[model samples]
Target: MRQEFTIWLTGLPSSGKSTLARLVEAKIRDRGFPVMVLDGDEVRTWLTLGLGFSRADREENIRRIAHLAMFQNRSGVATITAAISPYQRARDEARRAIGRFVEVHVSCPIEVCEQRDVKGLYKKARRGEIQGFTGVSDPYEAPLAPEVVVRTDRESKEECVARIMERVEELGYLPRGQVRCEVIVPADLVDELGTNGSSLLAVLASREARLGRAGGPVTAEEWEKIEQRLRALGYLR
Candidate 1:
């Protein structure tokens, strides 16, 4: 997106929040927009150093992130925060602080998150090694009404990214160009695919014949075909 806005990524630890944040950052950056990713782990080390896992400290951490995001937005830089941010109040506070905020709830079951845990944090929390750990000792208040919700347990990275971008685009936070259907036959292979009846588009039409496919936006190659047809009839040079 060309406009600077904060994309707040909140979820339980190991719920693929960081992964989704980086994927979104890369996708927006590819669109010629620079995005800043404020990962929770990295922020704790640099920004909110020596912060504990208490509820107060958690709110303070989110406050600090919100403060930074506001400045970034002012300076025309979009921010994506990948934080556990287990409290709803803290997230709401941040949203109010940053007017152009989009909260994305990276959802995954606790069992799934624990299974995907690489740091053995869940095991430690279970054994009382880490005090007030979220999803175990401390409560995780999931967002009741978030801008976007992606279930990492079932959806692939591409699916999750598409879902997030679609919602952001709908909300006018992302550019229209960023939401175009990108998988409509790769540009390089479009010529080889041809206008044959057995092509991918034809196959899709046949498969959805019972449902009756409606006309969609024209692709670059489809426009070229129109131009070629007009030229063949001597409409233009």
Candidate 2:
């Protein structure tokens, strides 16, 4: 990473924010950059230990994370924060504080996120066990015009990370030469490619990545092919 920047991953719980942050951190680390991840769960455990889920507390949590990210960014260190950061104003405040901030909105339907709720957070939220839960009891303000928007429900983690890194370079956060990620395509997917992989890959990396989500614009046949390719590439199970 030639330039210092903060890649802020924001999304509803289980929408893949924390996972993407770690993956991006590893990629930047591979490029010999000093990168650190401030995961929401981890930060809550220590950094903002006493914080609650109240709006004021959440904004304070974001401010504290932003404070650390800002200083790290200034010291040539990259910071990747995987926080729900559900409030728009707080996120905007963080952006103003961190000059090189790159906001990546990881969006997935609540249904999909609930399906991926290994921690059972969504279930608890739905049951009224967790108060002020985002995407259920509490409101989540989606980002407007983030540097990148990822649909994790459709894209595999590898694809999501690649897309994010690509956008990072495109936004002048990371140098062009540092954007490439060595994604290994599976034999099954490679065979399925049969010369059409490049086009499908283009679709995966395209600005239209959001098109194939459930009830999105893609035709059934097109969506099936995309899914097959993604499965072959080990991006889908």
lDDT of 2 by residue, 1-237 (tens): 367889999998999998898899998888766777878886564345445789988997787778767755654567899999999999999999988889999999999999889989888888999999999999999998898999998999999999999988887777755444333334544554454544323322221333322223445555556456556655444
Clashing pairs in 2: none
Error of 2 at 16 (Å): 0.6
Per-residue error for 205 in candidate 2, Å, reads: 36
User: What is candidate 2's CA lDDT for residue 97?
Assistant: 94
The candidate scoring highest on lDDT is 2
- Number of colliding residue pairs in each model: 0, 0
lDDT tens digits, residues 94-143, model 1? 99999988999999999999999999999999999998989999999999
lDDT of each: 0.74, 0.76
Total clashing pairs in model 2:
0
